[model samples]
Target: MDVLLVEDDKWLGQAIEIGLTERDFQITWVRSGAAAIGELQRQEYQLLILDLGLPDIDGQRVLQSVRRKQLALPVMILTARDETDQVVQALDSGADDYVTKPFDLNELAARLRALYRRRGGHASAEIQVGSLRLNVNSHEVWVADDPVRLSRREFDLLQLLVSQQRRVFSREQLERQLHHDETPLESNALEVHIHNLRKKLKHKDWIETIRGIGYRFSCD
Candidate 1:
């Protein structure tokens, strides 16, 4: 999963980033609401951890602008403001959840999971694809009834492909899902990952390569 953390406090920002990253989530951290808005426009994040007090633009305004754009991603407020009116206003203005400052990192993670679940988004735990099962929490992959060892990037790539099996994903789209740098990736990186996965999977044809297009995961 991808999350955008807009927190000004460096210590708390890094702490949240590291904690979520350990759970196989890719997080992009920004300091102010302006930066948060810019990043959200350019990228597709599954969730946002936004702080209400921002140095440049108020986080509330950022939240307002975000709701205006009408993206499907969920935003969770993480600010020191615990006032009842502010909390109600935030929820009214599209905040998915609220977390006061000094909140537990575990609590934040749980809320994010809950938001995703409520939105019918992906779970924080495992998901099944045919005979294969992917344990997202543990970053483990299994094919049929046996365990399958995969490199971190391979697993991430496969998870993206398998999760949306019917869709045709371009290399660029796959890169976004993998949360790599915005720069274009090497032409062969996707092919290389596919090759590695096929070798480990021992099913070279399970993933179909669309000529002159991209790749798709199809059982046939």
Candidate 2:
């Protein structure tokens, strides 16, 4: 999943980024609330991890802005404060989940997965579309009954497409979902991933290129 991590502490931010990346999460780390808001406006993210303490503006303000814009993005508050009032305030401000500092990386990852699943209107971790089955939590994919090994980017791309089947996704939209600001991508990187996905799934027509438009997951 693409995550926007808004954290100011350099060491903590680095640790969280490294840990989440190891767990197959695409993280874009920003130290200020302004940067976080800017990133949100510029790209699409599945989740947001916001720290209450920021250098420029309070994290609550950022959360308020997100709600005002009516972005249905799942947000998780990650902060050192664990006061009851603080927790209540954040939830009231539209945070889907809250995690205090000194948290377990495993637990954080699991919570993130839960939030993502709920946001996608999925009641479980597994998403089955036609003959393709994807276990979101396990990051595993299968065609019919046979297992299919996919790279991290490939899996993310497939999940996005299949979860919202039949929706035409522009090249820019898919590219943003698969990449973040820090990572430099080749010009044909998106095409390469799509090609690899079609070949691995053994169904060239599953992902249809809409000429000058883009691509979509087509079961028909």
Candidate 3:
């Protein structure tokens, strides 16, 4: 999933960016609230991780602005403030969840996944379409009861396509979701991933390319 991380602490930000990227998350890290807002306006993200201590604008104010603008983006507050009132305030301000500074990266990723699942209207981590099954939390995929091994990028691409079956995702959208901002992508990287996924799944028609448009998941 594509996530926007707003943090000012260099060490913490780097740690999160690296850790989440390793976990198959496309992370766009920004140090200031203004940059975060700008990115939010310019691109699409599945989730947002905001830190209250920003050098420019207050994180809470950013959340408030997003809500005021009626952006339904899921937000999780990552801050040092652990008080009950602060947590409540952030939630009331449109933050979906709150995590304190000294937190486990695994737990943070899990929370983000939960938020993403809920936003997608999925109550569970496992998503099943026809004979194909995917467990988002476990990072597993199965076709006709046979376990399928997939690279991280391949799994991400399949998960996205299956989760919103029939919806055509443009090549650019697929590329953005598969890679982060700083990563240099080859011209045919997406095609390579798609080809590999089809081979691994043993079904070429499972993912349909729309010629000039994009690709869509189809079991029919």
Candidate 4:
């Protein structure tokens, strides 16, 4: 999923962007609130990571503008302004969650995933598809009532695929969701993962392949 990151501190912005990218998130970092608003006007994003100390405009104003247009996008604000009044105002203004300054990247990623889960129709930590079940919080996967051991990459790949059952995702999309930095994904990494998963599943029906599009979880 694409995320718009609105942060003014150049160093913090770079650090957060790199950290989030490493977590398989597609981020577009902007330094000012105006550019952030402009991008929202043109394209779409699944989540917003906004900072209150924007250089051009207040982040609250941008949130208000986004709401005025009837776009119910999930937004989490990151800021040093953690006063009770400010926090309440932000929540009332439309922010889904807030993280004070000096936060951990892993925590942020978890929060973002949780927000996505709640917005995407499955708020629970456990997601099930077909005969497979995955616990997002515990990072465990089970196939056919038996626990399955998976490498971190394999688990992440499966999580991405099974989370959106029956949705076809292309190689490039999967690569973006799986690859970190310039780490080369031998063009066929997805095929390898799918093959490994299929073999592991050993079930006649699990994931289905689209002729020329991509792969999808068996909806039937």
Candidate 5:
């Protein structure tokens, strides 16, 4: 999923971005509040990670503006402030969750997943398509009651397609979702992932390729 990371600490931001990317998150990191607001206006993201101690404007003001504009995406506050009143204020201002600094990455990832699932109206961690079941939290896939191991990218590709069945995704769209902005993608890199996914799933017609268009998960 696409995530907007609003952080000013270069080292911390890079570490968080790398960690999230490894777990199949597409991130756009911005250092200042102005940049964060601009990105939010120009692009779409599934989640927002905002640091309250921003360089340009206060993070609370940013969150207030997002709510005033009626942006419904989930926002998680990642800041050093751990006071009770601060957490309450953030939640009241439309923040979904708050994680203080010096936190555990794994815990943060899990919280993000929970928020994501809730936003999608899923009460459970599992998403089932046809005979395939995917445990979103665990990153485990099962087909017809048999376990199937998938590489990180392969699983991410399948998850994206399966979650939005019948919606076609173009090559450029998939590439952006699967890769970071700084990473150069090979011409065949996406194809290779698609091929590997189909092979591993052993279902030839599950994912349909539209000539000159894109790919879609077949409901047939």
Candidate 6:
């Protein structure tokens, strides 16, 4: 998953970037509120970490602007302020969660996972489809009683499809969610991943190709 981190503190920003990267999350760090807003507008991110004490524009304004535009991006406020009013205001302004600094990186990671799962409409960390079970936290997949190994992209693709089973996802939507980079993916990149996933599952019928419409995790 990709995250937009808005923090003016260089040390904290670097620490967060390093920590999240270690956990398979792509982080884009911006030091100012304006820069953060620009990045948010130009790119797609799974979550946003906004600090209320920005050097340029106030982080509250940035959050308000995002809500005003109805971006629907999950935001978690990471700041030094622990005031009750501040927390309430942020929440009312559409922030999904709040974490006051100085905070534990592990807890932050867990919170991010929860936010992502919630956004994906998953009620739990584990998703079960037929005999296949996927543990979102451990990045583990099991088919029946045997474990299955999947590449990072392949796992992400499967998770997306299974989380919203039977919903047709366009190639563009899959590409954007899986690949955070702005560069265009190769024409066969998605196809290759899908083929590999099917081969790994050993169940071709698990994922159904929708002819011209892309792919679906067929629950039928």
Per-prediction TM-score: 0.54, 0.56, 0.56, 0.57, 0.56, 0.56
RMSD of each: 15.6, 16.5, 16.7, 15.9, 16.6, 15.1
Prediction 2 global C-alpha lDDT: 0.93
Tens digits of lDDT, candidate 3, 32-94: 989998998899888999999799999999999878774678899999999999999999989
Q: Please list all clashing residue pairs in model 3, or write none if there are none.
A: none
lDDT by residue (tens digit), candidate 4, 64-145:
9878874568899999999999999999998899999999999999999989887767688888876788998888988778
lDDT of 1 by residue, 142-182 (tens): 88878999987888888888878878898788767655656
> In candidate 6, what residue range of length 10 has the lowest lDDT sum?
176-185
Clash pairs (backbone) in predicted model 6: none
Candidate 5 regions off by >4 Å?
124-220
- Tens-digit lDDT string for candidate 5 (1-220): 8999999999999999999998888889999999988898898788999999999999999999888774678899999999999999999999999999999888889999889877757667788988999998899999888898998778888888988889999988888767855668789989999998888888979989988988988755
Better candidate number, 2 or 4, judged by lDDT: 2
lDDT of 4 at 18: 96
User: Where in model 3 is the C-alpha error above 4 Å?
Assistant: 124-220
Give the range of the ten consecutive residues with the poorest summed lDDT in model 1. 176-185
Error of 4 at 34 (Å): 0.7
**Per-residue lDDT for 62 in model 4?**
88
* Candidate 2 global TM-score: 0.56
Clashes of each: 0, 0, 0, 0, 0, 0
* Cα lDDT listed for each candidate: 0.85, 0.93, 0.92, 0.86, 0.89, 0.90
